[model samples]
Every structure is written in structure tokens, then in C-alpha cells.
Target: MAEFTSQGGILRGQDVVSILFPVAVIPLLFLLRSVFFYVKARSQFPGPPIRNFWVGNLDQTMANDVHEKWLQWNREYGPIFQTWNSPFSRVIYIGDPHIITEITTLNWPKSSAQYAGFRPLSGDALFVQTNHEKWRIQSKRLAPAFQPHVIQAQRPCLAKHLSNFVRAMDVVAEQNTVVDLSSLHILLTLDFVGDIAFGTNLHAISQGRDCRILQLFEIILPELMKCGLFPLRGRFPILQKTRLMYRAIAELRSMAEKAIKDARQKGDEALGTSPRKKISDILATQREPDESYTFSSKELCDNYIAFLVAGGDPTAHTMSFLIYQVLCHPLVLKKVRAEIDANIPFDTTVPSISQVNLPYLNMVIKETLRYSSPGFGTFRVCPVDTTIAGVTLPANTTLALWNPAVHRDPKLWDNADEFDPERWQSGQPKVRGSYFPFSSGPRSCIGQGLAMLEMTMTLATVFRRYDLSLESGFQMEYLPSFTLKPKNGLLVRAILRKF
Candidate 1:
């Protein structure tokens, strides 16, 4: 008989060995895990002990606002910290300008897995694209679309849209309704992007909840973000093949392809039906030029779909949140409106893009961008073993720099918490990497110019004719991911100015 039951079979010596072996091995495995985590962590720069394998801060990460949490960590820890992703993965959050600049130096094909997150949906649009020669070739080919004269032509259309927007606002004001301006702004921006992409308005501006376009947007964006945040599932490609994620992706792809096919057919009809009068000339320009770049009809479809997703939502969220910040400071709102009226009259039928350079309006936009950046920070995995800012990091370490934290660094900007635009103008040390509302360097937003113009112009038109105010019951919350947007919506009240 044995002190412990050995139903299978156990020799006299084997019973003792079997029981002792597990007891010895279990602690050893734990010791090894702890030792590895500790050695790798300490070998780098020092940081808070909060990052532990057992606690798994991803919960804390998902729970608290990363923007606030990052700010808190910077206050507690220094500018640089070494953290862990899981049992054996690494994550770094860099706040120093020099470190960030080195990482964003445009390694081209050597760029990070960020491209992978968007590639499934976007394929290879300029945003979320890292196809070395493909992007360069396509970018050069597409650059003609944004030339001075070509971009100038769109001004007429944008101005016309802005007038329609003003009229819409007038109606909303008359109703004395509490408007979630964020949702409204998102719809308006969606309309603008869809119009430019397909040469007609999608009429998303007044559409209610669960519209096809909005539904498709929610499907793609949240999943794409989920894929990025928790990519363990993606490290194994077979997991993506499972029905769990595949169906979600299929829905987004179906909608994207349908939109693309629709746009292509419309372009074809325009070219075939009226060669001399191309409806949206942007479509006509998609054809290959001397093989500098040639896009398949499918590629054209994907590109427009990509632009719609990338360009529309971020700008809408930014514009909406900008107004929210403006609401917080009625004095700032009044100042911005005064600048708009002085420069471009409230009833102005149309104004040149150059006219949006009104001082306070520009200040407000700059402040808005700083106060609430649209897109959150992105990640990079080292191509090979590398040390950054005294952190000896190995390849495959995911490095992320939280811009929201960097933007609010008191060491970098004055009254970091306060909504002050003067800091940008008043000899503000030109803080490096301090304010990358749009991610900086070569990979910075290619559509920054267009988005900047759209937001500034639209806001100019609205503030000039409207006395902006938030309703008593207004509230806002942010859901951070690829871009930052209000969770429920941005509710506000507005009235027409005496002007």
C-alpha cells in the first residue's frame, strides 16, 4: 500500500519521486517566470512596479481612460518607462522628443505592424499603408489631385456645402432642440467625404441611427481597433480564419467593396455617357499614367473606401469635440465668432479657403487639436534588437508613445490642463514632439491639409452666424482607439447671433 493512491501503478521509489517532482517543478516554473520578468524589466530603465504578470494591467488599461492614466503615470514615473504586455511581451511608452523622433524616421518597408491592422480593411490606401514603392508611386500619381488649381476647384463645392450646413443649423436652432452636435458633425463630415469620394452626397447628415454607412463604420473601426489592441489572435493567422472574426471582417469588406463598385460604375457611366463632362473629375484621374502607377478597378474601389473611413470620422470627432471645448469657454467662442465676422461676414455667400486664416479661428482650431487629438498613438515593433533612452529592448517589443500624455506635459506646455491658445502663439518654446495632434514625421496624416481646411472652414461658417451654447443637460464621454470620439454623442444648444 502507498501513502498516496497510485491507481495506475506505482513502484516503491516511483511514488515518492512522482509526488516530489511536481512540487519541485511548479515553483521552479514560477521562479523562472518571475526571474525573467524581473531581469528584463530591471535591465532597462527603472519604472513603477505596477506592471506585473499576475495583476495584468490591461484590465486597468481597458478600464481607466488611457489619456488620464498615462498622464498620471508620467507624474508618478519619469518620461520613460519599461512595461510588459503579458507573460513575456514588452511595451514601452516614450514621452521624450528625441526618442520619438528616432522611431518615426520613416523606415519605409521597415515600418511597424500598424500597416497590418488597417491592411485587411484599407488594403493600401495612403493612410494605414506601408507598401514602400506602391505608396510612393501612388502618392506621386495622386499628388496632382491636390495641386493648387485642382484643389481650388473643390472650393466652390465645399463652400456650397457649408451654406447648406448653415441652413441646417438654422433649422436645428429654431427647433430649440438639444442636438448631439458630435453625431451631427460626424454625419456632416461623412456626407462631405462620401460626396468627394463618389461625386454625390450620401445624405448622412440628417439620417437617424443604424444607417448602413454608420453601421458599416462601427463594424470595421471597432474590430480593426480590437485587432490592434489585442493582436495575440492575429499573431496566429489561423485564428483570423475562424468564423468568429471572419464574419465581422466579411461584413466590412462587403460594404467596402460595394461602395467601391458603386463608385467605379458611376465613374464609368460619367466617362462613357459624357466624356467631355466628367462628373467628379477625381475619378477620371484614377487611370494609370505611363505606368507610374496603375490601380485595378478593385484598387480604386478600396482606395475610395479607405479614404471614406480614414478621412471622415476623425475630422468629425475633432470638429465636434472642438465645439465642446469652445462651449466650455463662451469668451473663447465669442472671440472666435468676432474674428469670423470681421474677416468673413456672417451672411457671406462664399469665401476663399485663404479667408479662414482669421487669427482667433486659427487659434481655436490649434487649441482644439491640442486639447483633443483625433487619433490616438500608434505602435512599432523593433526590426531588430535596439536600445532607446537607456532601455535595452529586444526585437518584437511593441513601443507606443501616448500623444495625449505628451500634449499635456506641464514641462512642455504652460497651463497644460487649461484651454489656452495663447501658449501656442506667445513665445511657447516651440516644444518638440510636445503637440503632435496629427502624428508627426513622414507617416503623418497625408490628408492633414484637406482635413485642416474642412474643419476650419466649416467651423468658421457655423460660429459666424450662430451664438453657440450648450444646453443644460449636455454631456460628453470619449472612447479612444484608432481615433477618439464621444461615446454617446456631443449634446449642445445653439442660437443665432444678432449679426
Candidate 2:
């Protein structure tokens, strides 16, 4: 009886070990596999990372101002570094001009996962096209519409919007009330882009209120910045189908379709009406000269929405930064205002592009773009196994070209942190990849001319008519999102000039 009892106890012990073995081995196998992949992906490229086993460096990047985090990392790791997005995914950040020039000038395809968020809104638009050949053809067809002469035609529309913006500021100046200039810049840009893109005066500037589309964009942009950049919310498809996102997408689609329809119906009547050929007309009529390529109605809508979103956000943010930076430096403001006063006449409506010859004003704008570096960063992916900066990068690996790091590198620029507009006086100091606010090469921003025009025109108009001062106790912080925006808003007191 004693021997039989001992045998049963041994069997029971064996049973317990059997039950626990698989559970222990499963996680161990997963961990080993993860490590193997991580090691394989991160071969040779070095980074400064305090990494978590599961989330990698993602936790460190999830913050209010993540781009600043990138700047910090750049300082620690030098210009080129590898960062882990997940245990299995490696991202390389490159700031070297040679690498950047090679990637952009070669027209590298964008990583699908990295740019996936833009697709739901832009829908394979020119900026977000995954097909290299398609984008090339589309860019060619759309080139005429954005030529210097064509963009010049929009000056009247921009001038009209600036006039409205100035009048609105006059009210706040008279009241001696502090106004959120960031929000106002958004409103003004929305109105300007509205006229130029859809040929509609949205009156966002005149009313000083957020229109439905603008409100929808405000909601959509943050959601995208959250899920698209980090992808935590994107894990669940249900969250992507939220009502607010649905509404914004639907409304944007509707607006684009209507604009396209209107342009098609009106034809030359529509074409002749705008100060220049509007983006809507351009989209509606644009095709390959040989008719080999033409945008479908869906493509038209996508491109139009792209224009509205792209045309407004970065320009607005840059303008806001320009104003804020000038306000912060009283001497800079005095010089810029003096330049504007000397060049731009007090009652000049639709100031000719040539007429606004303020070299100092142009310097201020360029310097502001560099200081703010508002487009965030350009992302590209290696289409095939390739080498960049002497480091081997596997196919499909994401490469981040962060402008702020490049723009603020002390090695690249003397006193890089200091806001010096004089640095840009000699035709923006050719710095190769170092000074690319609009990015560079084939995939650079198409609406850059329009943005520059709007910013310079608005700056000249405002500085000529008003004296801007930062609100007391107001601290400016960078609100890094899809585009770098001013946190809260740039509150300022605008005192109308009697000149």
C-alpha cells in the first residue's frame, strides 16, 4: 500500500510539470523571436534609447511635443540614429544632406504604414500617392496651375482676405484686448485658401468664427496626430469609424465633389472669374497633354481636399509663428514694421508682388520658417534594400528627415537657437538639406509659392497697418502635431498704426 501511494504522488507531480511547461515555453519563444527580429533590424545603426521590451521607444515619444524629443535624441545620437517603433520595427532618422538629397531627389516611395493616416483624408492625392509614376504624371499635369504667374493671379484674392483680417484686428486693437493670433491666422488662411481653391469666400476672416469645415478639420487633425503618429487608437478599427471622423470625411468629400461639379458646369465662365485659375478649375480640367492621364472624380475630390488641408494648415501656423517671433523681438518688429511702412503703401489694395519689395520683411519670413520649421518632417521608406549615410537600411524601413534638428544644428548654423532674421538676408544662406523648410527635390511642397505669398502678404499688410505686442505673461510653446502649432494660441495686443 505504501509503494502504490508513492507511485501516484510521482504521477501527480509529473502532471503539474506538464501543464506549466507549454505556458512558460510559449512566452519564452515569443520573447526570443522578438529579440531576434529586433537585432536583425537594428544591425549597425546606433541610437540612444532607454527602451521598454514591449513598447520599445514609443513610450518616450508619446508626449505633447514629440518633435522636441527628436531634437533631444538628435543631440545625443548625432544626425543619424535608429529608433525602435516596436520590438520588431526599426526607424532611422537621417539629417545628413547627402542622404536626404539622395532619398528625396531619387523620389523614394513613402512607407505605406507611415503615411496611412493621410490616405483616409487625402485619398491618394498628389502629396500622398503611393504610386511613383502616377505621382510624377500628376505633378507634371498640375505644374502649370501653380506656376509663378498663375500663383500671382491669386494675389487679389489674398489681398482681399488680408484686408478683412486687418479690419478684424482693428477691433481688438481698439479694445486693447489680447487676441489669439494663432486662431486668427488659421481663420485668415482658411478664407484665403477657400477663395483660391474652391472660389468661395468662406468669410472665416470677416466673421472671426470657425466655419463648419474648419471646425471639422480642427477635430480631425488632432485625432490623426494621435492615432496616425502613435497608432495606439488605430489598433481598434471601431475607433477609426467614430462619428466625428465620419462626419468630417463625409463633409470634406461633399465639399470637394460640389466644387468639382461647379467648376465643370461653369467651364470658362468659372475659369475667367477667379483672380487666377483656381485650384478647383485646375483639378477639374487638368490632364496629360496627350490625354494619357486624367483624374477621376474621386481623384479630383481627393486632390481638392488635399489642397484645402495642405494649403491652410502649414501656412497658418507659419504665419502665426512669424507674428509671434516678431512680437517677441521688439527691435525685429520695429525693423520689419519700418520695412513694411517704407515699401507697402497704407491703402494699397492687392499690392503687386513686385511692389512689396521689403528684403528685411522677406528675411523675417524665411527666418521664421526656419526657426519654426513647421512642416514637421518628411518621411520616406526604402523601396529596396539600400544604403544611406554608409548604413545599410532594409527595404520598407522608415526614414525620418526631421527639419528642426537640421535647422537648429549648432554645427550647421552659428547661434542656431537664436532668432536671427539677418541670417536669411543673403538669399536664405544655401545650406543644402539644412534649410529645407518646404523639404527638397521632387516631392517638395507644391503649394509653397502660395504659402509664401500668403504669409508675406499678410505680414506686410499687418505690420504696415498695426503694431503687434505680445500679451504680458504669455509664454510661447511649440504645440507639435501634424503641423507645429502655437500652444493654446499666440495671444497678442495689436495696436493699429496711424501711418
Candidate 3:
């Protein structure tokens, strides 16, 4: 009996050891991993102290002015510094123009972990595509649609939409009422993109209402920002906000699918008679010329939605900021107006792209893009252990080109904080990678040409016929989102210019 009791006690002891051993060993293994990551990140470069082993610098990133925070950090810690998204995620921010050039010119793949937020909306579209070969083929397929000639051919569509915008503003000017230029710019761009890209008459400008597509984007963009900040939110749609976001994404995808179907049925009629094919035509193609890869129906629909969103929001926000900046500085405003007056006629006839010769206005646009670019940074990832700007980065390390920091770096630009358009006019050559508002490299913004044309035309059209002033007691406040958006909206009063 004594022997049996001893044996039973030993068995119980073994059971306890079996249970407690894993609990203790598992935590020990996790600790080792955390330590390994922390050491690796610290050894790579100088950075802000990691306050928490788990959340590491994520608290600072949650602040409303995170971009400004990044700038401050860039100043404190040299040009390249490390920050953590989580214990498992280390982000290296590059502010040095030379380093930026190296990374971008090499054409490193974008980080899939960083770009996961965009996948929910853009799918495998070029904006978030990480696979090199797939992205290469897809970009090649879509390239013709945004060629210079193709964009120039769409000038008439742009002019028509701008005309509608001006007519709407004329009514507001006659009544002497405050107009939300932010909202108007968004509507105008949407109309232009809808007509030119998809042959869909959103009528946002003429009808003076938000289309269902725009409304859906209004829901999706903010959620994208949230998902970017908290990646877990994207993996699990348990929260009400996340659930709503998924629903909106579904609806937008459905709308895009329907539009694709309609375009397919209508054939070439859908893309009007422009010799240059529109984005819709390119996306609706059944197969590539070589027939090696055929775009799935879902890819067609997602790319369609991607173009719609990309073509509208950033351009609209940029135009709004451009107008605001010009108006705020009277000297700048005077020069821009003088240049516009000299180049464009005072009458309502919209000037053609070739007819306008406003170098000063172009400078102002460049300055605005430098000063208040809609996107704060561009992200990339190294596929193999690589050396950039003298630092050896481990394979799969996330890299962010901090555009705002680079653009406003005192070392890069003289009087970096000041809103001076003439800086661009200096005969001295610009530093490579110094002012990439649309980013740099092969993956840079595909629609930059169209965006520039839109800005030039809109600025010339508006300033030629009207003088604008900020609303009484107006103060500019930026909203934190996927892009830098004006809080509430920009309120301004317009007075028709007399010839």
C-alpha cells in the first residue's frame, strides 16, 4: 500500500510538470523573440527609445499630427531612423534625398505588411501589388491609358467639368455667399474622372450632389487609415466601424463590377470616340496581347474602383490647398493672377492646354505640391539584405520615404517653412529626390500628368475670372486621414474679376 501511494504521488508530479513546463517555456520563447527583435532594431540605427516591448513607439504614432511627429524625430535622430509598428514590425524612415534616390531608383518591392490596408480596397491593383512580375505586367498593360497623348486628349472633358464648376461658383459669387471650395473641388474632380475614365456621368458638378461611389469612398478611406494604424482591425471585422467599412467596400466593388459589365456589353461605345483608349477600355480588355495572363473579372472590377478613387481625392485636395495657399499670400496671389491674366482670356472661353503659358503659375503649383502634398510618405520594402545610404538593412525590412520631412528638411531647401514659389524658379539645379510630391521611381504616381494638367487648367480658369478671399475668422486645420484633408472644409468668398 505504501509503495502504491508513492507511485500515485510520482504520477501526479509528472502530470503537473507536463502542464506547467509548456506554460513557462512558451513565455520564455516569446521573451527571447522580443529581445532578439529589440536588439536587432537598436543595432541598426539610432532612434527614439522603445517605451514598451510590445507596442514600441506606436503610442507616439497615434497622435493627430503623426507626420509632424515624424519630422521632429527626423530632426532629433539623423536622416535615417527606426520606429516600431509593433514588436514584430520595424519601420525605417528615410529622409535623406540621396538615400531616397538609391532606394527608389533600385525599385524595391513595396512592403506587403505595410500595404495590407490597401488590399481591402485596391485588391491586386498596381497601387498595392507587391509581386514584382505581376506588377510589371499589370503596369505595362495600364501604361498606355495614362500616356501623355491620352491625358492631353482628355482636356476637353476636363474643361467641360471646370466650366460647370465655374458656373456653380458664379451663382455663389452673385449671392456673395461663402462657398466650400473643398467640396466643390471634390465634386469637380469626380465628375471629370467619371466621364473620362469610366464614361459614367456622375454629374457631381452639374447635379450638385454626391454620387453613391463618392459616398462609399468617404466611408472606405478613413477605415483604410485605421487599418493602417491598427493592422489587427483589418484581420478581424468585429468592431462596428470595421463592419461598416467592409459593407461599404462590398457595395463599391459591386458598383465597379456592374460598371465593368455595362462597359463590356456596350463595347467600344462605352469609351467615347477618343483615339487614345481610356482607362476603362484598357481594364475591360479580355486578355493581354501575348495571352500569357488574362485579368480575372474581379481584377478588372477592383482596378476600375482603384482608378476611380485615385483619380479623384488626391487631385481635389491638392487643388483646394493650392487655391488656399495662393489666396493667403497676397504677393503670390498677385503674381499668379497677373500671369494667368497675361496668358488666358478674361472671357468665359476655357483656354486649351497648349494656349496657356504661365511659368509662374507652374511654379506655384510645384510649390504647393511641395508644401502641402496630399500623401505624407511612400513605403517600400527590401527583398534581400541590402545596403542603402551606408546602412545594411535586413531582408524584408519596411522602408518609408518621409516626403514631408525630406521636402521641409532645412538642409535640402532654403527657407523650407516659407511658402515661396520662386524657390523653384532659381537657376540653380534641384537636388535629386528632393521634391517628389508624387513620389519617385518606376512605381511613382501613374496619374501625375493628368493631375498636373487638371491643376493648371483649374487654376487658370478660376483665377482668370474670379478673385477669392478667405471667410471671416477662417483658420486652417488639417484632418488626419490617408491623405492630408482640410478639417470641416475650406470656406471662401469669390468676387468676379473685372477686365
Candidate 4:
């Protein structure tokens, strides 16, 4: 016993270190393994510094000025840029249109679905799901609902709503107040989509804030963003067990289910005296495209919720920022206002979103999308071994690409960085392969037509009624997210036109 104690307990310093060193080395070993894979993969592409090790360069990109910064990267490194996931992971940034168009159109090796765990059940249902066959079928079936013929019918409704929007704006204008043009734009969009989706008229334009349901929607959606970014949580039992996260998800789910139930009753009330029926409300009642559990009413709920987001916020951001641009370029604003006055004539009334199909207004809307794109940092997982730009890519690689980076390529635009509406003035609508605001191909945004219509009408109506100028010295910039948003509010003074 004495010998055992002396030998075991009083072991030599070298022996003690030998035993302790391995334990110390274990964590380092694990870290090294992760780093090795990350570094090796990242070497194949071009990228910026990792910057902050905790979050990599993503923080810089995530800042309010991310759009400009990312575009700066494109200027710094031509088209393809390399990105790292902070201390680990590899990302490829592709901004060239030739490459973008080719990648989006190809029947290719498999593409990543990105819809892991609850993502498939979330607002990401249509875009995130990887199943090509199902996507083909579902998209085809759903296409009819958004066709020009059907969408045109809704234009009258949209026009009427825009009239309310103008009245609300005029009230703000009449007081000579520095209006929160940005917030108001969002309110208008929320009420518009709500009218169409759940038949809820929060009257956001008039009330100037969301209703209880909209507030709940905002709460639920911010939580939904958490799942969208990290879609694996539902399967990883521990993450699923996290009460706060799960509870928030539960709340969102409950809210969505309630919205669906409420949707059934909304159509009657929404037909004008109410906010009026949107195409989505009609779709919600009719047959679903697919009978699969994946596309059921529950799925419809998720898709509609997603649709509201995709439809509303981005367009709001676009219109608001475009207004900011109008402030910066008075000449452009004057041109637009003049066009509106000439075509749409101000009276005791205003034209609908469809009435102002002016050439220059179209250019402004298109340019706004190009300059400050709605979505940024879009990610897709590689489904199979594929080749991009002649470089072989292994299966299961996550790729994050930005449109602003590519759209700003000088090669794509003569003065890519400049805000020139003249590029689209001819009414020819010619776009280089690399200039995609609505992401290209079969997987492109489904609600693009609606968004375009919304922008055109909003621009036409507002410019027709009011001439906008910044509130004495406010310079605004872009806020980066999955989409580009405006930082600080768009505060502009509007002068009403009297016929």
C-alpha cells in the first residue's frame, strides 16, 4: 500500500505532464480538425480577411452598411470572392452574371434544398425545399394564380388602396411635418398584403402602426428568422429541447394556424367594404396544388406567411430607398413628378398603381432593385458534385452569394455604381445576364410580378401627388440582411399637387 501510494500518487512530474498533456491536447486537436477542413476548402476561392474570429467577416457584412461594403469587395476582387465562417467553414461569393445565369438555369448536378428541420415547415417552404420534381409540379400549379390576367383584376383593388395611401401621406404632408416615409411605405405594404393574404385590414396606412395581429406576426417572424438561418435545430434533440426557442416557435405556429382559420372567414369581409379579397385568400379556399402533407393547408399557412414577408417588406424597403434617391437627385425626382403630373393628372383624386405605366418610373423601379437589391447573402447547399466556372465543387457545400456584389460589376454596367435610370429608359427592358434583381431561372422569385406592380404603382401615385425632398440634411444608407433595407428612417417633406 505504501509502495502504491508512492508510485501512483507521487508520480514523476514528467509522467503527470504526459497524462495531463493529452487532455489538454484533445480540445486543440478537435479545433485543429475543424480548422484544417475549413482552411483547405477556403483556399480554392478568393475572399476577404476573416476579420473578427468570433463571427468572421460576416459582422462587417451584417452591419447597416453591408451592401456598400460587399459591393466594395466585388470591386476589390473582380467577381468570385472567398468568404470564411469566422474561425471556420468556407463560402464562395459569385457576382458575375454569366456565372449567375449559367448556375441558375442548369439542370445540373443536385442543388442544395437548404430546407432542414422546421425550415420545410416554415416560410421557406417553396424556396428552401430541394426537391426538384416537387418544385416543378408545385410551381406549375401555383403559377396560374399569379398570372397577369388574374393579377390585373387585383390592380383595381391595389389602386384603390394606393388612393388611401396617398390620402394618408397627404395628411402628413399638409401639416408640413417631416414624414417617416420609410415606415409609412412598410405600413402600406403590410396592409396591402394583409388584405390579400388573411383579409386582415390593419389599416396600417391610416393607423400608421401594425394591428395586434401584425405585431404578433412581427414577433413570430423574427423568431422564424432564427430557424431559417439554422435549420437543423428541430432534429438535434437538445436544440429542440430549448424551451425559449421552442416556445417562440410554438407561438409562431399557433399564430399561423389562427391566421389560416381566420382566412376562411376573411373573404366575405374583405371584398371592398373590408380591405377586399387578395389573390391569396382565393387560393387559400380553392384546391391546393399538391395533396402531399408538404403542401396542405398547414403548408399553405407557412407559404402565405412567407409570401407576406417576401411580398411586403422588400418592396417597402425598395420604394422607401428609391424615395431617398429621389431626394438626393432632385433632377430625377422632378422628372418623375413631371411625368406623373403629365400622365396621371392630380385632381380631387389620384390614379391607381396600374395607371402610371410611365417609361421613366419603370426605370426608377428597376434601378432601385439593381442599386439596393432586396435580398443579400443567399445560401444554397450543393446537392451533388458540380462544376462552377470550370472548378469542380464537391457535394454538400454551402454557397452564399450576394446580388449587389454582382450587380455592381462594372463589366455588367457601364457605370455600375452610378444610379442611372437611363439604362432602362428605352422600354426595351434589356438586362445583361449578370444583372438579376429577381434571381434568375425556374427557381426565381414567384411574387416578383406583384412586387414590381407594387413598386410601379406606389412610385406613380406618390410622385403624382407629392414632390419629395429630404428633411433639411439627412443622408441615409442601406441596411444589410438576407435583404437590403434602409438605415435610419426615410424622412422627407412632400408638397401636394393641386389640379
Q: Among these predicted structures, which one has the highest TM-score?
A: 3
User: Clashing residue pairs in candidate 4, if any?
Assistant: 46-82, 47-82, 56-86, 97-434, 270-276
> Model 3, stretches more than 4 Å misplaced?
1-30, 49-53, 207-210, 268-277, 285-294
Q: What does candidate 2's lDDT look like per residue over 1-499, in tens digits?
A: 1222355454455566777899999999998997787777665566856468666677766577677877787778788887776776667888787788888888888766767766777888888787888888889877888999888878877877887877788899999998998888899888888877876677887666548777778767766665555454544446644446756877878887887777667764654555436666666766557964267888777877888888899999988888878888988988987777777677774467986777888888888877887786777887678976786667887788778888887878888889999887665556677878887898998999998888877777777777777888888888766688887788889887774
Over 1-499, each residue of candidate 4 has an lDDT whose tens digit, in order, gives: 1222363366666776788999999999998998887777667666777767766665554355656767788888767776554554445677766556666777332234234533633544566556777667767766766887666667766766777888778787899888888887878788777766655565777666535544554444433443334443344536433344456556656766776777655543554454323676656555535732324666677767667677887888889878887778878888887787778755625565446678888888888888777765355555677776676665676555568777677876778878888787565445455666776676778888888887887777777667677888788866554356666879888887666
| Stronger candidate by TM-score (1 vs 4) | 1
**For each candidate, C-alpha RMSD in Å?**
5.6, 5.3, 3.2, 5.8
- Lowest lDDT sum, 10 consecutive residues, model 2, at 1-10
TM-score of each: 0.82, 0.88, 0.91, 0.81
Q: How would you encode candidate 3's per-residue C-alpha lDDT over 90-171 as one tens digit per residue?
A: 7888887887898788888888887887788889988888898998988887777788888887888888888888889999
Could you give candidate 1's per-residue lDDT for residues 255-291 as a string of tens digits?
5566556656666586556432211346434675573
How high is the lDDT of residue 127 in model 4?
A: 66
Q: Which pairs of residues have clashing backbones in candidate 3? A: none
Worst 10 residues of 3 by lDDT: 1-10
Better of 2 and 4 by TM-score: 2
